[model samples]
Target: MAIPTTNRAVVATASGPVDVLTDTELDVPTPGPLDLLVEVRAVSVNPVDVKLRGGALPGGDGPQVLGYDAAGVVLAVGDQVSAYAVGDEVYYAGSISRPGSNQQFQLVDEKVAGRKPASLDFAEAAALPLTTITAWETLFERWRLGADSTGTLLVMGAAGGVGSIMVQLARQLTGLTVIAAVGRPESREWVRELGAHHVVDRTDLLAEVTAIVPRGVDFVLSPFSAGMVETYTQVMALGGSVVAIDEPEGVDTLPLKWKSQGWHWEFMFSRVIHDPESTAHRELLDEVSRLVDAGTLRSTLGTRLSPIDAATLQEAHRLLESSATIGKVVLAAG
Candidate 1:
């Protein structure tokens, strides 16, 4: 297959709203020494994409491409790349510093990429990377929860992309009793199917959680709204740990001081941004791929949009910003 000089991409011109997301043709980027040039077959929308598109964060000087999760076939590789070859099927949450997978072809560092699960297709596989990396790092790395650790885990917002995978990883990979906090009846069932041992309504969070685990939960993974931090602090057991992935306006630490509870933030982009040489993302994705092929893990793709054009991406952004999305929305490139 010949590499084209120009390929289609979804570019954010100014970043004010979904309207800023534009479909355009751009020069295909050449890979660096440690990079893989992947022909992107599928990509998924994440909250960070919405944030970046909405101008919540600075958009730099020129049109910025904004996608993180992707599953594709490697079309080329740089001299220093070793883990992947031209034909390898790969999945990754790429670096925020570079142009993203919203383009038909993207250059990703080999250390941040992993073999795609043999059992899943591109769209399904694309939904796994960002959320899986977030969930895995939050559970084992940030909270330092071991596989043998036996305790109850309270997952706030347990039906969204990260929450869906977090519930599964905790239930399947650890001895933790998973208590998922969800607001809607449909979401409650969704989390239960994903291996949540118990479900509590977010509307009545503290009371519902207290009723189930009267003492308090041993660990808390809050991936949703930041307003629930206070409730989480109140419901956490002494020595319990809390890990959050959302950027809340402010979090007060006074409540956690007395109980000696710990709080940590898991940003999946940190490894790609700060430590590009680190292979932690690749290793974790490899594990996730194995689990997925073995049927221990499943993709959380909730919707699939076709063609990977501007309008479809805008719709995806709208759904994500609406805060009503369950699982993930993926776009497949033709």
Candidate 2:
């Protein structure tokens, strides 16, 4: 198949609102030495995509792409690429520094991309990469919790994209008891079905959680960071660790000092932005793919929108910003 010189993409012309995302045509991106040029099949909307669209983050002089998670087929590979070749199916959460996956074609580093799971389709596979990377890094890397570690893990905002996968990974891979905090009745069941050992309402978080485990949890994964530092400190065991993926206004670390507790932040793009030698995403995604194919892990895709375009992407962004979405919302290319 001949690769086209130009491709269709959803470009954020000027960051402000969802209207900033415009469907436009641009030249296909050329891969760097360690890059793979992929024909994007499906893409998922993430909070970072909305943040980039809302002018919270910096944008380039020209229109900027905003998607992070994608599944696609390799159209070409650069000189140094060896892990993948043309025609291989792959999925990845790409670098924040580069052009994103809200396009018909994308350029991603070979070290960050992984083989797509054969058991899932493009949209299903696309939904897993970013959330899986975030969950895996938060659990095993940032928290440094091993499979043999035993204790209760309290996950705040447990039905969202990253939390959904985090609950499953912690339950399936670790001996820690999973305690998920969600507000809605449906979300409670959702987290329970995903393998949470206990479900507590966020409205009465401290009491409900303490009722289940009087001693306090050993680990806390917080995706919604607003007003959570004090609550987490009160509910954590001595020497426990808290990993947050959201940016709160500010956290009072003074309270954590008394308990000798540690606080860590997990950003999936850190490896791609800060470290050139980071191949952990590749290894992580490969392992996730194997787990998915083996049925030990499952895709967290909750909604699907048709025919990747500006209008569909706008709807996806709206859905994500509403804070009511349970899992990932994916857009399938026509």
Please give the CA lDDT of all the candidate structures.
Answer: 0.89, 0.90
Pairs in clash, predicted candidate 1: none
C-alpha RMSD between model 2 and the true structure: 1.2
TM-score of each: 0.97, 0.97
Per-residue CA lDDT of candidate 1, range 1-334, in tens? 6888888898888868798889899988888899999999999998888887776544474488889999999999999998989999999998877888999999999999999999999999999998899999888888777889899998888998999999999999999999998878879778989999999988888899899988999998877646666777789898888888888877676678788998888988887778767899999999999999999999999889998989999999999988888889999987
RMSD of 1: 1.3
Best by lDDT, which number? 2
lDDT of 2 by residue, 1-334 (tens): 5789989999998878889889999899888899999999999999888987887555555488878999999999999998998999999998877888999999999999999999999999999999899999998989777889789999988999998999999999999999999989889878988999999999999899899988889999988878778888889888888999988886776788889998999988888788878888898999999999999999999999989999999999999989889989999998
What TM-score, to 2 decimals, does candidate 1 have?
A: 0.97
After TM-score superposition, the amount by which residue 301's alpha carbon in candidate 2 deviates from its true location, in angstroms, is 0.2
